[model samples]
Target: MNRKPADTEPVTNAPEWTVSSLSGALKRTLEDAFGHVRLRGEVTGYRGPHSSGHAYFGLKDEGARIDAVIWKGVFQKLRIRPEEGMEVIAVGRVTTFPASSRYQIVIESLEPAGVGALMAILEERRRKLAAEGLFDESRKRPLPFLPEVIGVVTSPTGAVIRDILHRLADRFPRRVLVWPVRVQGETSAAEVAAAIRGFNALPRAMNGPTGPVPRPDVLIVARGGGSLEDLWSFNEEVVVRAAAESAIPLVSAIGHETDWTLIDLAADLRAPTPTAAAEKVVPVRLDLLAAIADLARRHRGAMMRLGERRASDLRALTRALPSADNLLAGARQRLDLAGGRLVHMLGAGVRRHEARLAAAGQKLARLSPLVLLERARARWATAAQGLGRGFAHGIERRAAILTRAVSRLSLQPLRLRAEAGRERLTIAGTRLANARAARLAAERARVDNLWKLVESLSHKGVLARGYAIVLDSEGHTVRTRAAVSEGMALELVFADGKVGATAQGEGAQPATRGRKRKSDAAAPPPVQPTLFGGGE
Candidate 1:
């Protein structure tokens, strides 16, 4: 049913609503409109994964920011952990928080909006820190062999502390100074960095109001494992710089072994977990005890050996001791016995001498012939002794004679060699003369043969054999018929001399210049017989 407006002016009729009513209606409208929104935004002012397992953070774009929450159930089921400044796509219902009087997204599902974007940001930041040399392996320090006090920069009330403390207790315990700081949030990175610098600034030898200004020998910047965004605080430039610049040997234990952050690279040593960091900081009590026992055993054995060696030396010294009187008495006894033996040996020697003399007397009769022979040998030796003078004289005379004969014989040998050399020289001279005569005769015979051969091959020889030699007008010999032509003046070389004549062709007649000699016309002159060419 429609009711009419009750007003003086019926034309101005608008419904009125209370503020609470209007707000409620508006909230409902928003919830219905975007009941399940899949919004993509970068997380801002993220502060949760708190004790209650709920996340409270703001999602913001360049234009605006809205409150976002992740309930325990939703967060537990999320594949990625929430972190500040992380871009994420949140699937949830838009609901109004009347108490805070702000509208927020009650997130039912959350995921990394863009892995590529996240990784790109991560890599960029990584390269930036690396360029600053924060991630250099050389700049990292070694963990203290045994830090008296360990300063940890982390959440004091978190499981990370508990795990570290429990592990320290289990292994070799140390005095741990917990510089409690929020492990995650917008300001977490700054707070953590401040804590690290503060620990470094502590006096090593002085006590402070809080018991001691703990200058920790080693530092552990640790955290429970989370997503890359959740662990981003440790990767922050501030946090990484703090870790790298620490004088204390820092041990980075950010997450599980698989999880890595920039701090891990910058730290001197990186432990896989808080517990492992505790384990790495010091050695086990039982192991130290075992080592001490081994040392003690070896020391005791060495002492015993030394004592035994000293005892052996003492025993040998004690045995070397002797009484002076006893030594003198022993020497006297030995001397008296030696005197008695000497007297007895002398008496025995005299008896042996008498016995040998009797035996020699009995052997003398049998050796009488040998004695006669010795006498003869002595006579011969005496003669030989007397013959020494004569023997030397005879040897000298014989040597002189032999020397003279040898000298003569040496001269005869030289003279005989000279005679033989002279005879050989005479024979060589005769042989040389005979060889010279034979060489001359052979040379003369070769010359004669060569001359005879020359006479047979001469041009006079050819003319005498009835062959005429023809010469051209150039005074050149025309051996071939082709060299002369008809009407060419040529010289005809006969046996006696050259005759000038005219060349004629084979069909032309030869004209006689003058009458031939009577003897030449009758018959060719008979060849004269001679031993050589010119003579013949």
Candidate 2:
């Protein structure tokens, strides 16, 4: 079925198109492919409008991107200048130029993609430079407090140079040698580096020509605000190294307050702007003059005070001369008096020491244990002799007394008395035996009677006589019938046995009532027994 339709149609082989025709179609296709396209990307290598009033740069994303162009007519309408690495949304028409046969977007309008992209780029660049020791504190040089001459490197035709010049004039008005250099574009980094080296290499005299001819004690690199790409010359490694290696102290002033460049870190000091760099490098003329005047006044005041102090010191010294002489004479007299008193005291002390030494020697001799022992031995010998004589005398007297006593106590009488005493002792011993036997028999009878009394008083004897003691559960004897009710269980205790019994039908009540009735009758009153078994 398809072959039948092909036969019905006419076909011929021919040349397709001309080069121009193909190119035209290609251009149209390319235009249609990207025409009126909206692109979001960061701007890199951004060059602002040139004399031709055209901006050229690349628009890039994370993966890929393309080149872009904007004529001055459209660029001038932009509220904010586009900077490198600044993400932007660009609305433009795509076109392919016939000359180069290249495709690009001709931007009509643009706005920031977002602020985050700029911050990210800043942070990334900071990290990269920081890792390379470009921002190391050790690399920074110290600026001279009062530089003899400041070398300025900046655009010869820009507000940056004029601002710097005016500020220097207003401040120290010192001679500043200008190193005219391009502060932007391709050759900017090279020009700035050359300017730094030139200043550093100049001799003191050649730096300037008259009136304290300028010697570059310091160098200032200055620039005005622009896009990141415009200010990129300051961030170039060459410019950074030049500033770091400069023999003269360098100050970096690039862009606005928020702009940071690698050269700023490498320089001795970083100023917010070109005008600030000039102000930082020199002191104000009026302020310095005032400071000098104040110093002079202080010096004069100090000199006056010093002169007054010297004069007062001289007067005091003149007055003190006579007093010093009097003090010397009085000191001599006091020394003489002190010497006499010391001699008298020494003489008295010598006598007192000698007496004390003699007393100490005498006490030492008295306290000697040998002397005391010798005296004690002599006393002991005398006491022994006295004791012997007393003992001999006492023995003689005792002998006489003993002899008289013996004579008084005759053996015949003593023997008779001893025999009589023996006979009496024999008789007494016989009587004592008889009395002991009778006492023992009497004690046995009293023991038997005590046993019988104890048996009669024993609880067992009472039980044997058909009497039972009732005790409560606590083992205390119940003395009265009222102590336990009719239904209360009671423990009856004998001498050797006990039984629990409940009071039934009040069996003891009649006995209690009969006793009460008998007590109520006018019978002879029953005597109560005391604890000692005495009738009361």
Report the number of the highest-lDDT candidate.
Answer: 1
Model 2: per-residue lDDT, tens digit, 1-536?
43566568878798799777877898899888877989888898886667788899989888987888988878766644577778889999888776677777899888656556545655666677779887788877778878777788987888888898898888888767889998876577788999898888777665335544446888888888988767767876678778877888889899999988878888889999888899899888899889999999999999999999999999998987776677699899999999999999878966865675576567646644344444544665575567558656765675566556557898777567656665775676567657756755664565455446645765678999888888754344567665555666679887678888977775444222112222222234223222223433
Clashing pairs in 2: none
Candidate 1's C-alpha runs over 4 A off are 1-113, 306-536
* Alpha-carbon runs more than 4 Å astray in model 2: 1-122, 206-214, 318-536
lDDT value for model 1: 0.76
Residue 225, candidate 1: Cα error in Å is: 1.7
* Model 1 C-alpha lDDT per residue in residues 50-102, reported as the tens digit of each score: 89988899999999999988888777656456677778888999989866679
- Against the true structure, candidate 2 reaches a TM-score of 0.40
TM-score for each candidate, following the candidate numbering? 0.39, 0.40
Count steric clashes of candidate 2.
Answer: 0
Q: Evaluate residue 249 in candidate 2 and report its C-alpha lDDT on the 0 to 100 scale.
A: 83
The TM-score, computed over Cα atoms with residue i paired to residue i, of candidate 1 is: 0.39
lDDT of 2 at 114: 59
